[model samples]
Target: DPEKLSDAIDCAPRGERFDWLLSVNINGEILSPLMWAIRDGKFALAEYVIDHLLEIRADRHAYYYGREKLFEKHPEVVTVLCSDCPALMDTLMDGLMWHSHSVNQGF
Candidate 1:
């Protein structure tokens, strides 16, 4: 069922991808994907979740929520990742790939 959710999020159209990924925070379980990864000590999965989150879409809504919630709950996320999952650092860099397609060009 969890994989199914991931698959559904992945299979969403490019135009809607950010919307789907950004909505993962409030999926009725009170835990975001990254939180789950961290809770389980799944560093690789944490990297994956970080990649999905830092997808670099021009979504002000997503950006603001990400800033507030992530900083509020996991203010030391970067430090933790650096110490615990250094090999996964590429995910953070990779997320910087500009997603010009399907962005909020006007909004």
Candidate 2:
């Protein structure tokens, strides 16, 4: 299954496009492969997906909702994401502040 998932990522149409990878729509839910992996508690699979996704050059978008969920479920995944994609660290920091505000505002 992992191998198949990896192959999907490799052979996906517009595989070089971050938007395509990060904006997979499942029943109108915006989820990426990484998001699905994290949501399913597949940490090893997530690590593999993250490493592979970062290897390609493209305009990467932050799946903020998925990211927030992942951070809440496993902060270490955020650490690994930042390490693998430093550009996303800024977005993560911004989201952290936003999350803090939401909690403070009782949202």
User: What lDDT is reached at residue 51 by model 1?
Assistant: 65
> What clash count goes with each model?
0, 0
Residue 58, candidate 1: Cα error in Å is: 6.5
Clashing pairs in 2: none
Candidate 2 ranges beyond 4 A from true positions: 13-17, 56-107
**Alpha-carbon deviation at 28 in model 1, angstroms:** 9.9
TM-scores of the models, in the order given: 0.47, 0.44
Q: Candidate 2 at 29: error in angstroms?
A: 2.1
lDDT of 1 by residue, 1-107 (tens): 34655687778765565455434655465555565665677766666556666654554444322333444656776786687777666776565444455657673
Evaluate all candidate structures by whole-model CA lDDT and list the values in order.
Answer: 0.58, 0.53
Please name the candidate that would achieve the greatest TM-score relative to the true structure.
Answer: 1
Question: Which pairs, if any, clash in model 1?
Answer: none
Q: Write the per-residue lDDT of candidate 2 for residues 16-101, one digit (tens) a residue.
A: 43454454778998776666665676666665554444443443652222343344444575666555655545444554434243
